[model samples]
Target chain A: MAPSDSDAIFSALADPTRRAILSLIGEHEELTAGEIAAHFDSLGRTAVSSHLRILRLAGLVAERRDGRFRHYSVTPTPADAVVAFLTSVYQNSLEQLASAVQGAATSEDTPAGRVEERSA
Target chain B: MGELILNNELRLEACPSELFALFGQGDAAVGWLFGSEAPLLRPGSLVRLALPLGGLARSPGTARVLSCQPNRRIDLMHETPWAGRVVCRFDPLDSGGTRLRVRVTIDDVEVARLGAELGLLGGYETGWWEVPLGLLISLSGPAGILGRSTANCAQLAVEEINADGGVMGRAVRLVVGDDATDPGVGAIAMRRLCRTPGLAAVIGMHSSATYAVTAPMAVAKGIPYLYTPTSEPTAEHPLLVRFGETPMDQLHRALPLMAAQTGGSRWFLAGNDYSWPRAVGATARAVIERMDGHVAGEGYLPLGSQNFEPLLAAIQRSGVDHVVSSFVGQDHVGFQRDFAASGLRDSIRTFAPLMDDAVVEHLGESGEGTWNALGYFVALDTSENREFLRRYSDRFGSCSPPVSAAAEGVYEAIHTWARSCRAGGGVEPTALLSGLRRSRFNGPRRCTLGGSLESLLLGEATRSGVRVLDELPAATQAS
Candidate 1:
């Protein structure tokens, strides 16, 4: 709902490596941080850790201790912040469009020549 | 390639003996290459070719020749698709089918390339389209001989497509199976789907059990199993195609909607005790887990159980907020009736993606207000479904399919297999599977199958080669 949470989620997704991380999770089901870091093209473990940390902080992922390894899962459809934003934006636009179209149609004072049913 | 040509291009590997079948028709150099019914040469005309090995290649295209000498010269000609003219002049031996000096001058390069790849010389076109057709033809009969004749939609589609020139001018031969919904029998049925000579892809398997067992066969053998059932997730192998539905693809869309609707993070799962149930259950578990929901309880039972008193009691106990039931066949009927009678209907509603017309219609009042994972609902508001229902009711005495089971998928599989066979450059399973994967068809449902091996999942492929609706159309489906 706030600007800060949006920045956090978008910033976490900003890196190309993070995008690649999302795809890896999709393909392999779930992966530990170490296992995910293993898929990178020569990126060191520390760098991967920061990326994972960013994802964790943004609530995009949740970590569980698997023995010595900390495995992560994409916080299933993450509805806390980012999903809420996208949902509200699209929902509001749809609502506004409906009102605008309804307003135009019922306005009898408008010229008949200008009045036309727009393909929604 | 369309359904027409694909049906005729049979499986080359299963029946190895097809390579040496003797249909006792005289060799027309051209006639022997193609089948005898080719419109290339005149009747009783003699076309000869110089041999690669030795002697003169003498051949008559469907001619009634009187006498012939040994090893030096011979005569016969029949119009065939293999070549314009075929001359097989044999130096007469003692007995049996002669090993003649066969020389074939084929006019088409594409035809020659296809022939060379399959290692077949001039055996494609021949006969009165019925004589030789009845020879090895005794092997696999024309479509609808599995004899139920309950659904000849695939055959009708094949014939129609063939009449319109076929996928590359080959005739598709659709095959019928008695899957009986057993896994092992389904596997065997799938084998016949691929290995039977001249069949393109197998547009068969109405049971998820059959498709699951057969999915491996299609993948290992490189035969495209065009699942038209619309509910099995058969996209695990490149050769496995779903012209139907997989629950995961559906749930990815439906659960999101349901979650948004109920705002509940808890759900329940139930299905008949079979391969489909377990696999789909596991998938649902995974999906719910992914969607941030907890599975409250799941119920599994063999197909024939009539008593649902305890399962109903369990759901009540679990306090599960949402439920999904994956039951097929008469079980759907029994469950609906029992569910209606259970008095738990108000408290425990379910979403079943596929329930047949037979069960739903039979249920009458009981079927009201229930949601099924439906590609084609009896009351579907779409024009396509309305027309299909009308035609089906007029033809088979039902507005909707007896059950959506694999009926349409089977119908689509037939067409898909036929089409794949036609488009397959050569009559090989690998090519046919690839061809079928690349196809998308508009049928009773919007059906498409991908060639990617991961798409060959048996548990979730649908008939008509489309992704089975995995979930209700709310959260994930693009409106």
Candidate 2:
């Protein structure tokens, strides 16, 4: 994934309100703007509406429009992409760890070190 | 490997409802399970698990809450890199407390793969490909009290670097070793770190005694070693970069200001008998003499000396109105407590060059009215400092140890090295050396690496923590 896209997703997920909104929408199939706003007493309808817009822009939420109201639901794509990116970064780190230990084992030429490395 | 199930049970002193309330309180209560500053927990919320291997390497896996049943249980399903389930059950015990059972079920193959990948069980070999940095800091002995917060700051830097795409598109991993605050142990740790494959650089936050031994090893191994605590200025080496405050950096402006406030100039110098403290005494004498101040007494004791009666008696007899103490760690705390207990604190004020948040925290009420000058303080009010503290608290939880100059120096040192690597186009020793010579980073302190002068702040310790008093003028030259 492009760095910018990943950054956008992360930035969107960084906010607590947006994360709560995502979780709320994910708990059900879909929720109208009014329904989501009702869950947050401190946030007004317009404030919740703007949060949904930002989440939609980051591709974290999908919007569906009926005659008079719009419904929002969590999009699995961005979450999946975030997990994939994190997984790759971690795997790369582990690969580096393996190489470091192996390099140390090769340099020492000690049977005990090699045996411990294998067992570890 | 097909499947693996790990089960653990613990009986806690809290009731089931009390135990359940902890999870909902915030990250500070549950940071051991979830990474710090995790999103609010409810069904369907995404939670990031803390990294494995004590956070030495990053392997963050995201999980989705499958169900949360009030005080009874909470279930989560791992969503990436592997398929897994974590079930946490709280059972109210008849005996009084709560019995908590946690069962984690995952694919056995994935577990083995992760272990092998972390090099716990070595199987695959590839050429050195990632930027591996070494952190050699004191984790035991006199200076060990500051170890956890210092290491946390370094880890925060690495995570932030990775979040920002890492150094030159390569992920950075930290390899930590304990120096035990002894030069001999430091030398061994330095040698081991220097021997790591493709080690980019090493950052040391231990004493100058350790640096005297470890810096040479890093230089010999062709690795750039950034020393991140106050130390005596040594002859420049290409591979050695000193990023902390020098004695002159702390004394030049602070001495005159402190003298003006106290209305007298009879000064007593005290510190642990080490190279750094000796250098501090020399610089304090020079600065005090330039201002026509009188040096009434001076003393040096071995590190970790708990009995300060002799020192307190000497201070009382010397009739000094101001003291410049260079003691560190437990000695710093012990001396201050004894100074206050001796009732001398009411008469003579202390100016400590090596004072920091951790030391001040340990000093508690005895720390009040003491003065400190450093490159960074936890109370420093700046946008960069606020953001730095926010990220720090987010990563380590708000209740973690406050940031000290030593810890902040580690954070800045790592970022400075990363910036230099970017400027030099690679992590080669010579290129990085040249880049470091001109590297400047905007952190809590706007620092210019290898520069003679740096921005220093004067702070007075209060009951809570150090409060920034004023910005001291930069010294004319390195002492």
Candidate 3:
């Protein structure tokens, strides 16, 4: 199965550019790429457009066609997905910490493949 | 590939076929383990025996005895205290040597869930002793642990340990090197790890890196080389613990059980071109032929070989029902993908002993519904495992663990290695190695003195070395 919509949303959020788009939408409700581009001092119009595209794919933004141009808007999703993804990512870090104490418990032993000749 | 029939005993340069003949169902395993003729046994590949009478017992009065020549690669199958089965194998190489493989198919999903639910993550590490060993051998000098799946798995392990609190306040670090699966790189990785600071200890090896380069570096560094995953006789290495089970451990149980379960004897072997498959094939062929099964086809592909159409065609033409695949690393996902895509997905049922979590994770949905044999399954029905799975999923994303000793071994060994570091206080290399040697944990398998947990820890510790755990003879076990 593909990543959950929430997971996709969280993964999408990992990028700074994507986050910037969301921030822009938050500050000035439902803006198109041209309007969002003016807010960034260094980003090009194309860059802004690409960022919006990613946000839209992640379901963080909604889009509607307006002739040659499409308008972008942030669509709300269930908050629990965000919470769950964050919890999981953070929990792995915690598990790493919990592992410290467990690591002190003892020492143990543990621990292959084929030949396919090909160039990718 | 040369053999001579001497006094009715087939003597081969390497017992490619011997791997199969050694494993039998029921009393066969019980008999070999006890050094007696397996007692009168009934049909059915699995026979539950009393724990006291059994070699590795998680609880009392019960142990699942597995039997099958599922593939030439798989050589052992046995029960963990957790009531799970783990299968180990040896894949013959096209060039030379063997690739050791281990897998635990979760038969009792409840047991796995329970173990996960109980919060004792150790259950997931049962029978991991073979993992590192097999992996190190695989690196035989191809690619080091870094950049490869081994590196990825190691990184994941290290990340988990650090994220979990550095194993008792000490950073749970790994002195890793590029086995690049190449000997030179393996040596380089070993030397680097040996010199690495703040790392508790080092295990596993590179190709051509040999025990000489790795063993001494670890020993000289005084870092604990908890386990070496090679099938070569391990009793010689004092600094390096040997968790590499002989042919009788998990395979003895797995082979016959697979044979009986599938009720087919003909075999078709597929593997990468390397030492692991070579060694494994030599031993396996002997075992299967003894059971009156013919090796319908045997073929070897270059390591990372992309095309399996020839092998698949042979399998189809040979009219073989069972396909024993001895593939590893990236090839694992590739071969399995091909297996599923092949028309044989429905016609031929594949049973592999080398499928581990890292490999299966790559396979993804492609792996579901395949009739693969396992020594442990992530879905086993164990209170402890259930909790571990839930936690692991919640923590590490939803990637399910491949059932077998190694994944669980990695799971437990992280804890064991951490505990060793904690015990040593400062957690130095050799100090940690020594600490690991002296300690035995009650691991998730529930065996006393942590013998079984020891099995898993040893597997993890040996991760950096040759994959000897894959060739475990049916005689050895980690219950």
Computed on C-alphas against the true complex, the DockQ of each candidate is 0.01, 0.01, 0.01
TM-score of each model, paired residue for residue: 0.47, 0.61, 0.46
Candidate 1's C-alpha runs over 4 A off are A1-120, B1-150, B166-170, B188-195, B218-222, B230-235, B259-265, B289-292, B356-358, B378-405, B419-427, B430-434, B447-479
Where does model 3 exceed 4 Å of error?
A: A1-120, B1-171, B174-178, B205-222, B228-235, B244-248, B364-376, B397-407, B421-434, B445-474, B477-479
Isolated chain B TM-score per model: 0.57, 0.75, 0.55
Give the Cα error of residue B118 in candidate 3, in Å: 43
Tell me how far the alpha carbon of residue B64 in candidate 3 is from the true structure, in angstroms, after superposition: 36
Give fnat for candidates 1, 2 and onward, in order.
Answer: 0.00, 0.00, 0.00
The stretch of ten residues in a row with the least summed lDDT in candidate 3 chain A is A110-119
In model 2 chain B, which range of ten residues has the least summed lDDT? B117-126
Considering the two chains of model 2, state its CAPRI-style docking category: incorrect
Give TM-score, chain B, model 3: 0.55
The lDDT ranking, best first, is 2, 1, 3
Ranking by DockQ: 3, 2, 1
* Candidate 3, position B422, lDDT: 57
> Which lDDT tens digits does candidate 3 get at residues A25-111?
643336778887775556789998877777677666788888988787656552333333332322222222223223211112210
Query: Model 3, B214-291: lDDT tens per residue?
Result: 666666765556442323343355456544333234344455556786788887878776666555565557667767
Per-residue lDDT of model 1, residues A1-120, tens digit only: 454665566556444355445434533346887777675546678887887888788766678886788887667644244333222322222223223223212113431111111121
